[model samples]
Every structure is written in C-alpha cells, then in structure tokens.
Target: MDDDSATGVAMTRNGSTGERQLEGDYLTNAQGEDVVAGIRMTKDLSELKKEMPDLYAEFERIALLLEKHYREMQDMEFTIEKGKLWMLQTRDGKRTAQAAVRIAVEMADEGLIDRQTAVRRVKPEHVDFFLHPQFDPAALAGGKLLARGLNVSPGGAVGQVAFDANMAEAWAKNEGKAVIMVRPETKPDDVHGMLAAEGILTSRGGRTSHAALVARQFGKPAVVGASAITIDLTNREMTIGERTIHEGEWISIDGTAGVVYEGQLATMVPDIKDPWLIKLLDWADSFRTLGVWANADYPRDARRAVEYGAQGIGLCRSEHMFFETDRLPYFQKMIMADYPVERREALAALLPFQREDFAGLFRVMDGRPVIIRLIDPPLHEFLPDLVELVAELADLKIQLKHAPDMAAIDALLSDIRQKEQLRKRALSLREANPMLGLRGVRLGIYIPELTSMQVRAIFEAACMVVKEGIDVHPEVMIPLTSHVNELIRQRTVLEGEARTVMAEQGVTIGYKFGTMIELPRAALTADRIAEHAEFFSFGTNDLTQTTFGISRDDAEAGFLIEYMEGGILPANPFATLDRDGVGQLIDMAVRKGRASKPDLECGICGEHGGDPQSIALCHQLGLTYVSCSPFRVPIARLAAAHAALQETGRPHDE
Candidate 1:
C-alpha cells in the first residue's frame, strides 16, 4: 500500500468491466476519511510517486503481482509512514464505459480472456453510456463541482437554475434561456417544465422514480437523489453545505459522472469519429434476435434513429407534428371549424404539410417500414386551455366595462363574446376522463375527416415516393382500438383514401393497416380484431393505465409515490411493465393475434419500449419489435442483444 493515493488500490474491473487504472487520491495531513469521503482536495497516485519514488516502485510491483494472482485486476489500499510502505488492502478497480470496452477488448486480444468472454463482460448500461455526451476533460478539471448524485440519464448539461417546473418552463420558453430545474422531487405536473429544461436536478428519488424515468424518456441530463443539496423553494435557491445557489445562476451538470458543477462547462459530444462503438453495435446486431425500432414523428427523429441503427419506424405519432409552431394554426382551425366543409378546407391546407412531412420521413428511412398512427388525442388538446381562455374573456369584459369610447366598448364586447363561445366549445369538448374518453380510433370514427386527411396524406406521400423508385412501406395505425369494428371501420376509411390517392397520383403502392391494442378488451379479443387488422402495436402506456385503472398523468404526482414508498407497487407500472397484469394481456394478445393471422406482425410502441427490463419481457413474450424514442435506439439495441444472449445461455453481464 502507498500513502497519498487511492484509499484502496485495487486491480479490479468496474461494474462495466472497464480497464483498470492506478486510481487513488491523497490529501496532505488528513485522515483516511478526508480522502475517502472527498472532504478535502486530493491528489492522484502520481503525486505520491513524485514525492516517494522508491515507495511508488515497490507499490506498482505488488499491484501487478496481485492482478496475476487473481487472474484479474485488483483494488488495493495501503499507507506509507516514515519511509516504510504498507499494503492495507487490494481489490479490482472500477472504470468508465470507455475503459470497460478498451479493457475487455484489450484483455481478449492479450489472451487474458476469449472474445465471447470479453463480449459478456461489457454491461448493457455501459453501452448506453457510450452513446451520451461527456463533459470536456480539461473544463471539468477546472470546474467547481458542487455535489454528486445518482446519474439517471447520461449526458452533459449547462444552464441557469430554475427552482420549479413553472419557473423552468417560463425561463426556457419566455426568456429563451436554458435552465436546470432544481426540485425536492418531481411530479407529473412538472413534465412541461422538464421538457423545456436542459437538465433536471432533484434532491430525492432514485433511478426508478418519476423524475428519473421521465428524464430518461425525454433524453435530458438528470441527477437524482442528491441528498447533499437542500432545496428552498420559498427562496428559489438551493443550499449545499454553506454555499447557496440562487435561481438563474449558471451551472453545469454531468449526468454520466453525477457531478453538479458551479458554472457552465464545455461539453464533448460522443466520440462518433471513433468507429469502435459503431463496430461494437454491429457486433451486437449480429447476435441480437429482437428487432429494435424507433417511435419517431418527424424526419429529424427518423434520421437520428437510422443513425443509431433503428431497424424501422415502429411508431410515428403524427399528432406530435401538429404541435409544431407552423402547423398548429391549421390544426386549431380544423378543431374550431363549425361545418364539415370548413374542417375539410382546414384539413386541405394541412394536406400538403403532412405530405411533405411523410415524404421527408420516407427519404430519411429509405426503404424501411414506417408505422404512422393517425391523430389520437381529443380535439381539446389542439385548443387553448379552457381556464386560460375563460380568464382572458373575463379580463376582456372588465376592459369593455371600463372603455370610454362606445365603438371600442362594442368591439371589446364582441371580442369577449367570441372568446366566451370558444371557451364554451372547449369546455363541451373536455371530458372527465379524456384518456378513456373520445380518443384514438373513437376520434377517427366520430370525426371521419380527421382520419381521412391523415390517411390521404400518407397514401399520397407513398405514391410520390414510389414514383421516384424508393420502396416505402407505410403502415397506417389506428390508436386506442378496443373492438374489431373499430379496426374494420378505420381500415375501410384508410383503404378508400389509399384508393383515392393512388388514382389521383396515377401510382400504386402497397400499405398495411393496424390497430394499437391498448384497451384490455382489445387484448382479450385480439383474435377477433386480428382478423380485420394486418398488424398489432401494443400501446403499453395506456394499456398500463387502463389495466390498473391508474391515470398515468396524474397518478405519480398524487398517490403513486406514496404507493411506491409504501411498497404497494413493486415498480411504477408506467415506467416498467407490470408483467403479471399488463404482461398477461400482452401475452394473450400476441398469442391470440398470431393464432388468428399467423403472419400478423406485432410490436410495442410505448414508454415501456425503451426500458431494458420491459424489452427483455417483450423478447420473452415473442414480440416482433420494440420501438422507443430516437435517443433510446442505441440503448434498445444493446438491451435486445443482452436479452438474446441471456436466453441463449451466453454470458449476460448486464
């Protein structure tokens, strides 16, 4: 053992099977806890070597012997007092993803391990870490690190502070500043803020918590369960020991490292220039049996997915496209239109936009299959918030009452009345339970033109792509489908639109139509529905919601955490698959759906798709594919490979 270095000098590999390094630290005139607890500034093992060369040489010799004896790396701890060296402890060293890959590959090449053994050494989570950006080494070395926490998501983030979700969103959206949302813990209501923020820092909650789960899903940099920091929401500041960080203070965070820095720090994007990871993924693909796809909506997402090795587009939620700034007007106009002609005209205005959107996606995906789900949410989602509209109308009425000019007063009154009408319409559209209300296939059935316009755009885009000699497999997916008739009705409408577009473009292209088996009834009666549907995509998000009768949006914020802490639920069913209840439904659907139509293709396009555990379950259940967000494509690929290896009785390190 050597003094002034790592507490325990170990020659052992990390959880990731990373390469071992002579890693240790030393603080002058301090106890071992000072160095171990990181309470004092510390120097690396090299500093000790510089101070005592003879002792350092002897320590290195013993370390090598320890590794040889164990046939692996070792972690060691020792002390040197009065020019005498002492070996206190020795074990394997922990390392980063890069070190893990480099070490394993080098070990295999060095005859320390076989190729299969090396492959088995790397964890799936480590593979995921390779895909995220890191803080620049030089910048991080110079930066002031405030605290450490569990890294729920992997990436580097730099932004000003925001105390709560509302502040986070307001700062990001209104001030146009990237913000790190600081919270005691997060709730479902914080999603908007989470989306707007560049990173999230919470004082409580572990990896499987709501905050962490959503952060991963959003692909944000997140550090959770940070106990060192105390959040003072009343003052909009966070206190770490004696240091207080106020709102809007510039800060940087490394989710991969789980370090919160005092100010902005430079970041290095993943080393895509290095072909090592690319080669590794290719190797993974060779061994993996499950198909990994992406839940992408736009061309950008599709392109990202393709770059990350997504096999195809498993879910293209077209409704998300409507939320884009330029396209929202057409969507809102269609929603507010009183007559079918007006709505159709609004949809007509949107047709070219949708066609172009689909065309771009096809171009990016090339010949890969793209499953596009038609509009699924209720129309109210396209309108202004009912409460906000009413408040605006009330303020307008007050202004009208105070107006000095008669003409101005009359105009104000007219405007107020118009606002009131829109507000009333929005209210009328609102349901006590919107998720279980008029959404998905029901929306398509009730509002024929909505589905018609989307189908028309899809078919027309396909025809255009086919005329250009690019093979495009466009699948129209009807969401929230619970019955055979819903599938048949939407299929008929989609087929009619397909015919119309084909005839109009003077081109023919084959397409598939499917329904999302979200409702329990749909899964239970999958055989009957499969007869009318060409494919099935399990919408596990809503499936979990309906199965447990839990409102995903509101549950976590309310009693979900309590239930979790109380051990009422093993995990957040929304975050992870509830295999017994929700999984049973999934199993039954896959079995029955395939029994009815042996050629039926099935996959899951939900939040669960990106979860490694859920991916394993899907693999075990024989699902064709699992689709997740574009950023999760790499994670899913690695997870799928891990699952395949585990099933085949190969080394499953993860």
Candidate 2:
C-alpha cells in the first residue's frame, strides 16, 4: 500500500525479517538528533511469534491474556526479553500531534529520541484533537458526579443539580456554582437549561437526538434517553419506580455510563501520563504513520481535542443536526407527508440548513477526514400517532363550518387518514421491543429515499467544499447493524445514490462505507461485517448499553447507582469498560475483522477515547485509533505519550 505521508514502510507478516530490520532502524533513530523525521520504518510481530501454548511463563500468560482481552496491536513491557514474554507494561497506543512534539523533543532532551524522529512522529491529522478544552485529572476530581447519565461529553463539572431547565438557570443565576441541569429530555425551552446546566440528560433519544445536539452545540456534558428515572414535572420531582426524589437534590451523574448517584462519589481520572500509554504510542509511531481518525457526532465532542490524540474524524453524524423542536417537525414532515415527493421536499427544505451546519464543521476541522454519517433514523420517529391524527380530523369536521376551506381540509384529511392507517399498521408490525427492532437498516430497506436524501446532501457538501479545493474524506456509516447482510443492503442504497449524484454533478469523489460494531451480533460476526466494510468504528456506547441490557436512558435512576456505590459494579460500564463482557466482544471483533481482512482500519469512537485506561487498552489492542470529542484530544495525545514512555520503566527487557 502507498503511504499517506505520515505512515512509513512497516515489517512483513513474519517477525524475523521485519524484527531485524526494525532493530537496525531503531538503533539509527536512537543515535541521531533527527532520526524519526527521516527514517522509514516497519515492525511486524505476528500472532505466530507471540503464540506458544507450551512456552508457559507468568509474563507470557499476562501478555497473551492482554492480547486476548484487547484483540489488537499490543506493546507490552515484560521482564524477560528473549526466552519469555513478561508483562511489564501494556496500552493501546497513538500519538497526538502535540505529544509527537513532546516525545521527539523531550526525548532529545533526555538523549533518548532525536529531533528528526519527533517530526516523523507528528502528523497533520494527529495534532488537531489536542486543541480543545480538556480536563486535568485534578479538575475531574475537583468537582463531583452528583448523578450519572450518558456522559455524551467528556470532562468534569462542579455545579448544583437542577431538575428542570428553569431550575438549572435559576441555580446558575447567582454565582459560583456551575449548574448541572438534569432533565428527562431537553426541549427548545430546555435550551436555556442546556445553556445554564453544565451538562444535560434525557429520557429518550439516540446519539442523534435533540438533547445530544443541543448539548454538543453548547459544548456541555449530555446524557440522553436516561428513562430509568421518571421525571414528575408537575410535582417538580422525579421517580425511579419505588424511589421518589424531589428537585434541588444535589447528586453526581456519570454521563459516560448513565450512572446517577446520591452525592459526590470519588473519582479516579486515568492519567494521560500513565507509563502504559507512552510505551504503546512509541511502538505505533515506530510503524506506519497512517493518520488515525476518530468518529465524532458533535463539534464539542472535541474529537480533535481529546487527551489521547486522534488524527481527525472518521465519522461525524449530520442528522444530529437539530434541537428538540426541529427534530420532531423534520421527522413529522418525513413521516406524515402523503407522498414520497412531499417527504423528499420536506427534506429538501432542510438541505440548506444542513449545508450551513457542515460548513461550520468544515471550518472546525479546517481540512481533515470528516466522515459524516448520513441520516439513519426511522421515519416513524418524526410522525404523530395515527390515533392523534384521526382525533384531529374528527375535531375539525365536528367543530368547524362547511366551506371551501373545510372542503380543502377534508381532502387533505382523507390523505392524512390513509397515511395514518398505513402508519398504524407499520407500528403493529414493529417489534415489541424497538431498540432491537425495526430501526437502522430496516428503515433504509423500506424507506430507501431517506438514505438517498442524506447521501446527496453529504455529497453536495463535499462538492461544495471540493470546488473550493478543500480535501474532505466523507465516510458513510450504517448504524444498528446486527447483520452483515443489513450493512451490505444499506450500503447498496447509500453508495448507489451517492454515485449517481456525483456523476450528475460531474464531481469525482471517494468515500468508505463501514458499519459501527455496536452489537454483540456485529462483533461476533465481525469477519462477515469486515468483508463488506472498508473500516470499522466500535460504537461502544450502544454496544455497552446493549451488552448490559441496561436502558442507557433509565439505568441511572433505578439501581446502577446503587450497584456502583455498593461495589457491585466496579464502575459504570458506561464510564469505564466492562472488559470481561463488552471488551471481549471488541477483542473478538478486531481479531476476526483482521483475520478476515488484514490492513482493515479499526478504531473506537465511544466515550472511552478520552479515558486514560481505555486509551491505554486501545494502544495494547493494536487499534488504528481511539476517537473522542474534540476537546478531549489533547488529553488523549498526552495519554498516548504516557503509554509509550511507560516502556522505559519496565524492568529492562533483556
């Protein structure tokens, strides 16, 4: 394969030839002041070299287990060098553009790595995630997790937990407290609370919901669809079935895992400097310089600004394009319209609005790999109920006068009535439990036009940008894919349409189609998904929620908090990772995906990207990259450096 400038020639499948070559390069780079910048390198230590069931040793077991758990590229520091592999250190690694600076420059200071090696480590894309507002572990501990929900945004908060938007604003009104607004879901009215609250929460909504969009717009922590707790807006209180709680109660919410607790719980912010992180990235930098990309749905996610540096965006969701009001209306228009033309027209109305949104994003990224996930939600989400529509028709005929206006209303009403009937039938056909139901690819299967409009808009944006000479690598990803057949089907529709539009406009472009490995089925059947997918981005958020059978929306209000507080659940699986459970799938998926397709690009786009421990794990796993919001990039980069440097402290390998 050709190099993308940042990547270098790597070792082959066999370790002996590549290992010897890498050793020579390692010596030269180590000696010169500018070795990294100039020397082309490669190191391939395959599974065959690392695997030997009979060569049993403590470190070997540890290394094997670490590899088994992570299922990706691994850099482990072991006590033994030749005879055995001792577990001295382990971390998934990738360098931030800044950390590349620090490692190459600082290593020179320490007489370890020289200046040229530093520039080689730094890449154009890697530096971007570092430039956002990141939390110092001290800052994370500075505040508290009053109540936990999906931490859509990374970092910490010190604020009064207000139940409603109004309370959030009122509390934030007086002074020092950075208000953390709690809500069952956010509305346009909640915009103020979103403005006032340090973070936001919702009873229902996906990564592409109103609450997520508004919070991301404001750069606030958002935990959406946390339906575990019922909010009593009338009583100014909330209920999690048996437990009743009122407003003004101070609690910490872990937006990462949707875990809400009674009071401030102790926090352990994983350090970007953990020795494990440094050792890992150093190993990655030693190989191909392929710019690592992150999948981001929001601008504030700071994909470019995470602690563990990500090169740029691999996927960015565009339909996460509106606030509460716009979402329902846009959805309603798509669902309630009498004809495909009507719905397509409604989507057309949203086009200019979407283009403008992408324009701002283009500005944020400047020029990088921003793979926009086209609209992938079900149409029913936007439509009002048939029962409600029927009721409206009855009210109009029974209450209004008999005139031309009424006649026109009657005609339109008849069409609406037919559409309502079909919609009702569709609902009945839907699965009893819709989370694993008629969503994702199914929506595209029936409503192929929905995917069509989104693909066109994305391409139009690309064309708009391309005409300006801006290089944009747009990636289209299919969500909720439990089956490989589903991804292939969805891609056929999306790619087919995108190609058509490209041809008509006389614009040439290239994009990758991939699936988000967020389900057990997706992971278990990864080899199949890889056959159709150009790359893979592990959607650990949904993956975790589905894996635990926890309502990401409601888990916090019920018993997850209790479980964490009582030490039943070590940490919210949403916040940290449940390595044994969900991680096992990620490990399986990577190994299977690679086994089927060597050189398959893989990465993580969940909240774990900024997490120091998770980042280290990604380093050890041999993942292509770990992506978080832009703000968290700097921290990710530093964490990557730590994983690399940790190798130094390992009881010298020899």
1-654: candidate 1 lDDT, tens digit per residue: 233333323344443335455656655445567667866677777776787788778888887778667655666777666566678876556777777667766665566665555666677677777667778878988999799999889889899999888888998999999899989998878888999999999989898787886787667999999899999989888999999999989989888878899988998876643455565666677777889999998898898899888989999989988998998988888888889899999999999999999998988888899999999988889888998998898899789778999999989988887787789779889999888899999999988998898998898888888888788999889999888888888888779888988999998887888999999999999999999888999999999999999888777666886687568898889878998999999999999999999999999999999888999999999999999988778778778877888889754332
- In candidate 2, what residue range of length 10 has the lowest lDDT sum? 1-10
How much lDDT does candidate 2 score? 0.60
Q: Which tens-of-lDDT digit does each residue in 1-654 have in candidate 2?
A: 111111112111112211111111211112222223664342222222334334333433554455446532234432223434334355643333334444444444444444334433444234332232333435345654333445565433435567777777777876656666766666556676677776665666666455765565445656767767787778877676576667766555555445455554444443445342345344444433223455566656533343345567856766567434655566556665668789888777777667666655555565566666655554444555657766775665554445468677677677656655656754654455667766666777777877777778778877777788777677777777888888888888788888887898789877778878888999999998999988888888889999999976566434665575457887667766678898889999999999999988888887777666676677667788877765556556555544554543332211
| Backbone-clash count (model 2) | 92
TM-score of 2: 0.55
Note each model's CA RMSD in angstroms: 4.9, 18.4
Best by lDDT: 1
Name the lDDT value of residue 374 in candidate 1.
Answer: 91
TM-score of every prediction relative to native: 0.83, 0.55
Task: For each candidate in the order shown, give its overall lDDT on alpha carbons.
Answer: 0.83, 0.60
Off-target runs (Cα >4 Å) in candidate 2 are 1-310, 322-330, 363-367, 378-380, 383-432, 647-654
